[model samples]
Target: MANARVDRLRMMLAREGLDAVVLSHPHDVRYATGYHSILERWTQMEPFAAAIVFADPARPAILVIPEANLGIVAVLNRDGPHCTFDEIRSFDMLNFCEVSRYVDPDRNGGQLAEDAMAIAGAIRGTCQPDIAAAITAALADHGMAGKRIGFDEHRVSAAVAPKVPHDYRDALDFMMRVRVVKTGEEIERYRAVGRMADRVIAHAGSLLHEGADWNGVQAGICDFMVRNGVIPVDEGAMLFGGSYDGDDFIPDLFRTPGKRALRRGDIVILETQGVLDGFWIDINRTAVIGRPSADYQRLHDILRDAFLMMVDRLRPGVSTNSLPAIGYEHLKAKGVPAPEKLLVVAHGIGLMPLEIPLAYPAAGLAGVKQGFVMEEDMLISLDSLFFGAKLGPCHMENVYAITAGAPEPMYAAPLELIVADHAPADRASEPA
Candidate 1:
């Protein structure tokens, strides 16, 4: 998998004329190196650091971590991208030595000049003072001193800018221009994770009955994810009955399932997290214990319709901004009170809960704009959320992939409202 990804990355580098890329972010590193962490502890400090694809295959050299990381490096370099040991030293000069071999003048300087101009890109979580100096010094030594380099402006730290040797621009356009679209292999991996998450959500739903409390259900969901190997990146699980006026919106005292039995007409909302291979897929559902009230049913129907409309309209060349507004316009056309201060939509799913191209009106970043264009292979969530002060809030969210034609919904659950007609036959006792 790493080699396949590297093959694409190498092609990207050749196209861009880059000598090599110095990656410091764990996600990008994992994608490029396929080397999961080797450190026994989860400290911020990364002891086992390395770089890959310096120039060409013959010139390839990957820095090895210490002895403790030997086994991990062997596994990661199984496809053979040239592994070189970085003996620990006060200056950590070995890191510079291995990197320099591909760029700097060897005592064999004359021959090195031909490859000297090869482009070098550096990636870091944030540019800190020390990291900046190290990168700057490394580049200056390599003779690619004044060339144009790239950095993700939004994601790169301000402190790290002054240390690089050349001009750097926001590389988000460059990186996403490369990473966002899913390959066939990536799609299958995402699907496997998505299905695993679905099962966890369903299992969690089975445990939420009449007397469940906010914390109890939340805890159950957390356990469900852990036991099933899905890690939740976010903790906000909004659970409220018909319009508690957003009172349920705030952090409140945790409650346990007690004598407060959920009656037949009560609205129950279930939101779940799904993670597989460190990637995320979210699924949310709203239900009624028995038959729902007329208003609730109608409102749910509208929200569900809005969700489907958004799904139908999702495709390449469409703007995310249009989705929520269209849904709002539809609701307004139907005489539904469109509250100005509600969260109508959002785009958050991937390795992190939120990646980019958000869909909220208040989300005023240029990255969220329509001209930005939704492209093929991009994964996003199409959501329609309605808050009713009189009936609690209702939400419909689905994960989909932008394809050649339309956005394909990844989840296979029924889109309509889900009604739990009967609790277990042991109705006398509440679910724990």
Candidate 2:
């Protein structure tokens, strides 16, 4: 299959007048070359892989990786359509195999010999002493020497500037602009991960009991996600429940989960985040232990209705800056106390949790204005949170794919407050 993501990067580079882009960010490399380095999980300061994309459509993108990963890249290309690099180059890092010795065809005939030959071919004339030298050589070979090249990371740009003769510029904002829209494959991966996270959050609701604590719920969520082929992001899951500081009830959403046990009628907010392939899954749901009070129910109903209204308004050409106003007006009309406290944020979500058009504000980010219009095939998460001092807190977050007609919810979870009852009599005796 053709890689549409690389094509998009090339188009963006051409439009911006950049000759080529050298990307060292782990997520940027994966999005460009479809290669995920194991070293990315260990360190971010030292990049073990890089991707070089030229503005010219004819010049194929190159993937510069460590020599240790050549075997896995060969295997992935042989077994499936995982790796999407047009050319593979390597640099000497931690070597995994002895390059001097050849695999005996007689002893390892079928797959081993084939893989060995592929690895040898990949590293034959492309391996360099280090990442800077490897990228410099690739740029020179591709006629990009002394050209206007964009670097995604500032540190990588500074390190490579001394070695390569090129006009380097920062391209972090350029990269975000290219990644705002999702391709067909990326959308499919998002949907798949969204379905998995929905199931995981539902499992979390089942674990709610009188004695259930945040740590236990988080542990269960992690175990469940690992068993189901999704990698948990960060703390696996975040569990926040309502509590009373003194005579007044303080609804704090930012409190870290501890050993405090969950009690009946306490509102709980559960957010599940995971990754499948290269896409991220972030969805949140709120539930109450046993029955909810009338005040809590009314508050949740108003929030849910407001959430639905905003989601329905998501379509092509709708300004994202206007979404918060729409939500605020609806909440105020419904007599929601402190409607200004309701935060409505809409932003793209794919390779990362927060992508451009950033929901929150920053000092200097070009092309990331607040009133940007939503486009088709843009995967976004609409997050709404309201913390009331008396009624506790309520949050509703969901991922949606902007389409031609109506926005499609990536998961099958309902947008109502979950009323989690006590554990069954038979299962209550078992350990959590």
Candidate 3:
């Protein structure tokens, strides 16, 4: 069966009149080839792996990686359907795998001879000395030399431009455009991760108490996520307090967690992100350590209602640019103070938290505006925040699957402010 993702790439490549696309970005490579390497966890100081996707669907995509990853790729091809690349090419980097040792039946008891032989076979005619030469050789072997090729990152383009005589163009936007729409498999992965996020948020809410500090709460969340098979990303768990000095948004959105203990009536902005099988989970839920003041209650209600209203308006053909306006108008109608301070952003979520076709204006090559219109099967994260000096920061974010009718919430968690009353004797406080 033809992979829908590769089909989408071919359609995009044909539309752009390009012969192929070279993807060096970790997420891009995984999206194209379905091969995730541990080395990709590091930022691309230098190009590590590349996936060459040809415009012709009949031409199987090629994945280029270091020789160290050959065993994993061979095992994936042998044991399961995880690795999607039809052809695997490798380059010599570190001498991590010694095939001779593994293939020795008497020395190793022949336990891993099959896998070792597979790796050795893959490295025979397909391996090169370095990334640049591997990509150059792959292109030349596939008759892509001197053809129009799109490079997802500039550094990868620069590295390969010297070795291959091809017309290379920047394709960051093009790849984002192709990735905006989710496939069935991608949607299932999102659903799974969304459920995981809901659990993490619940666990985080349970950990909030009068004396709990940001560091402890964050550590608990990270531990819970990792134990449940999700890799935490970014700040892992960001806990913002109710203390800010300006009308602008939180100055350091990605600030590390501190050891300040929670106090009675303290507003805590609990935000988290994690990854499962290349899909991301970004969720935000606000909580109060004790009873919320009237101002805090009113602000949270308005933002929550406005967020729900906007979510209801999420159907096919709705422009993402219209979402923020819906939120602002609702806040203004509710007589909320400084309604514009209630920042509203709706973005696509998949391999990355913020994918293309953003709600805000994004310009591409030649000053072309990149705006998104909601489509079926697209996953969107609608985030709303209102940082009131008196009430602290109130936030609520939800992931929705854009359908033909109403948007489907990926998780069943209600959008309500959690009130974690430290004292059970405090009967006046109600549950969130």
Candidate 3 achieves a global lDDT of 0.75
Number of backbone collisions per candidate, in order?
Answer: 6, 0, 0
Question: Which regions of candidate 3 are displaced past 4 Å?
Answer: 74-79, 97-113, 119-124, 158-163, 234-236, 239-252, 358-371, 423-432
How do the predictions measure up, each by TM-score?
0.69, 0.90, 0.87
lDDT of 3 by residue, 196-281 (tens): 88887888788877776566667777787787888887444553433323322232355553535667766777777888778887
Best of the candidates, TM-score: 2
* Residue pairs that clash (backbone atoms under 3 angstroms), model 3: none
In candidate 3 the C-alpha lDDT for residue 221 amounts to: 77
RMSD of 2: 3.5
lDDT of 1 by residue, 1-432 (tens): 235556666676677766655554555555555555634225455333433343344443333233234334444445554223222111132354344436434364342332222111112222212443444444444444555455443223243345444544444444544455556666777888767756755655565555544455566666656666666533533332222223233211232232244556556666666455757767777776677778878878877877788787778877777777767766776666654323445463565455554332324554434424677777777655676566656766778888889777778776667675655553332222
